[model samples]
Target: MTCIADANVLFSLLVEGHVAHEVARGWWDEQPDGAVGTCLLTRLAVLRLLTNRVAMNGTPVTPTEALGAWGRLGNDPRSVHVEAEPAIHESRFISLVSGRESTPNLWTDAWLAALAMSLDYEITTFDRGFKSFRGLRLRLLSMADK
Candidate 1:
């Protein structure tokens, strides 16, 4: 099965000190060639969060460092970078958002869900928020609430 790495899992994989680091790392390492990946949205989110001063608990990473991490991830032979088909992506995103009662914060989450749905990739995430969107195939990572 194809797997899509969500921002949470991507972030955990990048930051060795993260609570989910080991599990994320292990899962990442075990994926067969071409079986795991992440979309541009997830990549952007990882870069933004990793380099943000406030979001990263004041320990902001340098842009260069974040880019290097992204490069390394992309260079992995087993990884695929999924791009969104704009028409399908937008339509699915809107359907997911409008079909449910959701706060404005869920817009990106909806996009992620839509992207995965369109590509038929099962999402890997630690966030339970993804559960709100229907018809998503999720490989929810086992992690303690932090």
Candidate 2:
């Protein structure tokens, strides 16, 4: 099945010290080439989180370092970068946000889920919140709650 690396899993995979790093690595290491992909949104999220002081827990990572990590990830044969089809992506995103159960925190998740749904790519994430998105193909990583 085709899958996409969501920000949560990408962040964990790039940060060796993240609580779920090993879990992310285990999932990442086994994927066949072209089986999974990354979109611009998820890659940017990883870059933002990696460089942010708060997200890094006071340990600092420079922009250059974060970019290096980003580069390394793209080098992997298993991960291909995917582009979004703007029209369908925007349409689906709006539909999700206007859904009956929509919540403020769901904006990004909704966008990502909508993008995945538009492209038929399953999202691999640690966040169970994705369950709220109907018809999203997802691989909810197995991990005890932190």
Candidate 3:
């Protein structure tokens, strides 16, 4: 089965070194070659994070290293494909968050959810916001779940 990974999952694998990392790693290990996919937003989100780090905290990750990481992720034989459609289904995301009072702005989660729906791939994330998005199959990973 193919899975669309969220940015948080990728971030954990790349920087946080949290349980999500192990979960993603294990999921990758189990997938057949080229069976793991992600949305283009995921790639943009990672780049944004790296950019923010450099701009704000002055964390010194060279552009070459960042590009190498991105390339490695894309070249993985287990990666099914990376969907880059931004105009996919997104209205449902706006509607879902419009009524929530306590929910923080999670635009990336919305995009990821919509992409998972469009691609018919289960979502792999650690964020609980995904739990509220019905019809999009999700696999939320925790330390205990891992």
Clashes of each: 0, 0, 2
What is the Å distance of residue 56 in model 3 from its true position?
12
Model 1 local distance difference test score: 0.84
**Candidate 2: Cα lDDT at 24:** 92
Off by over 4 Å in 3: 16-20, 51-60, 84-88
**Candidate 1 — which residues are off by over 4 angstroms?**
144-146
Candidate 1 accuracy as TM-score: 0.89
The lDDT for every candidate, in the order shown, is 0.84, 0.85, 0.70
- lDDT per residue for candidate 3 within 18-121, as digits (tens), equals 44667767656677886667657778776666556653256736667766776788888876556464455666566656766654646667767777777778
Query: Tens-digit lDDT track for model 2 on 17-91?
Result: 888988998998889988878888888899999998888888859999999999988988888888755568888
Q: Judging by TM-score against the true structure, name the best candidate.
A: 2
TM-score of every model versus the real structure:
0.89, 0.91, 0.77
* Colliding pairs, model 2: none
Error of 2 at 1 (Å): 1.8
